[model samples]
Target: MKTLLLSLKDVEQALSMEEVISAVEQGYISYNEGKVQQPDIVSMEMPENNGETDIKSCYNKLNESISVKIASGFYDNGKNNELPTMIGTILLFDGRNGAPLCIMDGSLITGIRTGAAGAISSKLLARKDSKVVAVFGAGGQARMQIYALCQVMNIQEIRVYSEYTEELPKYKEYVERNTKVKVIICDTPEQAMKDADIAISTTPSKKYLVDKSLVKPGTHIVAVGADMAGKNEWDPEIFKGAKIVNDSIAQCISRGETRNAIISGIIKESDIYAEIGELLLGNKPLRESDDEITIFDTTGMGIQDNVTAAQVYEIAKKKGLGKYFEFI
Candidate 1:
């Protein structure tokens, strides 16, 4: 049989933010319904190089496909190597026979899928009139988050706070060139989040960046950085008495921001309001009022990669977008 090889550009041509958002939403529903088998993530850290790598896999019964992804983040790559900080590859297999079907670059898919998750959470949990967004990073994922969010919310302004001040102007320029939203570079996390309706953190900091006191009522927070143990962005205290939603309770508790909260005794596993799937399936209530604070903790899921990669592969096949080679 022939296995297709897709490059990053090939995968990009096959995906749209709106379609990815829809696919991620369905992935969540399938997960909640027990239609997906996602294993625990395997992670390795290279502290000396300031890098981490993760392996995630999932089998989706609904899509009848399997995806295994190896993604790595080298924090100093940009500064020292002049390369992207995040890089990855995805392997897709036929669920019926376990035959490899496609191999594709995973960097773009990872960013967009993650961005889609943030957008989906905001659509389901944030207030409808939310116009201002506070973003806590200025990397590719942060840009992807803003791009995906623009598809769902009528955002007027984006307040950005990043430790890398040199990147702010470039980030702002990119956003303004692509969208109509005005971007404001903030001096502090508080300045960025003050009165913002939605806040998203996309950094890889080991320390919590947003304190509980800085978060106001009626704000929807998306915690995007803490996909592994010891990586945190939101203070545990922010989770207290807040409506918390997770992409996967088990995964989140083990590695996501939810882990920090539970470990700190600020919240319990029972305190989790709902998984995103539960909210989508109407098993639990969404934001009940505009005054309620809500948070979505996502540790990244293999089902997300599976469903998205499945779609991308199909599209690549139909369009003859990638090369094929025989593999026995």
Candidate 2:
């Protein structure tokens, strides 16, 4: 069997934010319609190594292939070794005969799909008139989150917050150079979140960074950093008397932002309003009113990886983008 090897550059060439957002939305729809077979995320934590790796896989009935993605984050890599903090890979196989189709770099895919998921959630949950956006991290994911939101909303101002004071200026320059959106660097998380129509937390913080006092009533929060148990971005009290939705209930309850809330008994499992899939399938409403606080917890999903990897493979194959060789 022949297998294609796609590099990070090749993956970047094959995928676009506009195309990815639509594909991700359809992935959610597929999950809602019971057309995807996905398993819970399996993870290994190595505190000694200052890193963690997660494995997720899925099979979409409408697609001809199945995919498994392995992603890792070594937080100290940037400071210790001058390497990127995160890296990932994806393997796609033919579903029928289980032929190895391709192995591709998944770092960009992971970030883009995550950003796309936020965009999808924002469209379905955020108020139609939402314009201002606050991003709580000055990293790649934060940049992509803003870019993805711009595709679906008319964003006029962007507020960025980061504990790394030096990184914030660089991030602001990057945003200004790439997009027309007005970028502002805030000194504190509360300053960044104030009066924001939409807020996204992309920092990897073990403790809560956003408090309920700073969040406005009509704001929509996209909690992205808490993809593992014991990781969180906001206080459990934020979920009190608010609408909560998850990308996957089982995954979110165990790993996402809701994990802390659930474990603390601040919120019950039955308190979940609905899944994003249900919203896409029209089984549940998006936002009940403009005054309601809505939060979407995304723990990352195998099905997202599956659909995204499949799309990249097809595009690369058609464009003759990646290196192909016999692997089996």
Candidate 3:
């Protein structure tokens, strides 16, 4: 059997933010409806190097495909090795015969799918009149989140906060160049979040970056940083009286910000409002009131990778985008 090899550029050519958002939305619905088989993430930590790696896999029965992703985060890579902080690879397989179908770069897939999740959640939970956005972090994922959000919301201005001040100008320029949204660089998280309609956190900070007092009553918060245990960005108390939604209840309860809130005794497991799928499937209510504060806690899910990678594979095949080789 022959397998296809897709490079990062090829993957990028095959995907658009809008298509990815739709695919990820359906992936979540499949997950919620018990149409996908996703196992618990296997994680490894290298404390000495301040690095961690996670292995995630999912089989989508609806698509008849399986995807396995190995993603790593070396927090000091840029400072020490002048390399990317996050790197990943994914393998796509035919579910029926267990034959390898494709091998592709996963970094872009991860970023887009994660950004799509944030956008999907914001679309369903954020107020329709939301215009001002506050973004925490100034990295690739941060850029992706803003780009995806623009597809769903009529954002007017973006307030950005990052510890690395040097990247702020580049992030601002990128946003202004791509989406023409006004960008403001803030020295503090509170300043960025002040009066913002939607706030998004995409850093890998181990310490909490947002305080409960900074959040307004009508603001929608997307917590994207805490995908692993001990990594957190929001104060546990912020979850109080807020409608909490998660991408995956099992994953979030184990590693996302929801875990932190549950561990801190600020909220219980039953307090969670619904998974993103429930909202997409119309099984639950969306933002009921403009004054209601909503939080979307996503730890990232394997099914997102499965459906996205499957779609990318089909697109690449139609475009003759990837190299083919016999492996077996």
TM-score per model over all chains = 0.99, 0.98, 0.98
Model 3 error, position 90 (Å): 0.6
Off by over 4 Å in 1: none
**Candidate 1, TM-score vs. the true structure?**
0.99
lDDT of 1 by residue, 71-130 (tens): 999999978778899999999999999999999999999999999999999999999999
Q: How many backbone clashes does candidate 2 have?
A: 0
Per-residue lDDT value at 217 in model 3: 89
Colliding residue pairs in candidate 1: none
Error of 2 at 96 (Å): 0.7
What would the per-residue lDDT of candidate 3 be over residues 120-143, giving only the tens digit for each residue?
999999999999999999998999
lDDT of 2 at 187: 90
Off by over 4 Å in 2: none
Clash pairs detected, candidate 2 = none
Model 3 is weakest, by summed lDDT over 10 consecutive residues, at: 74-83
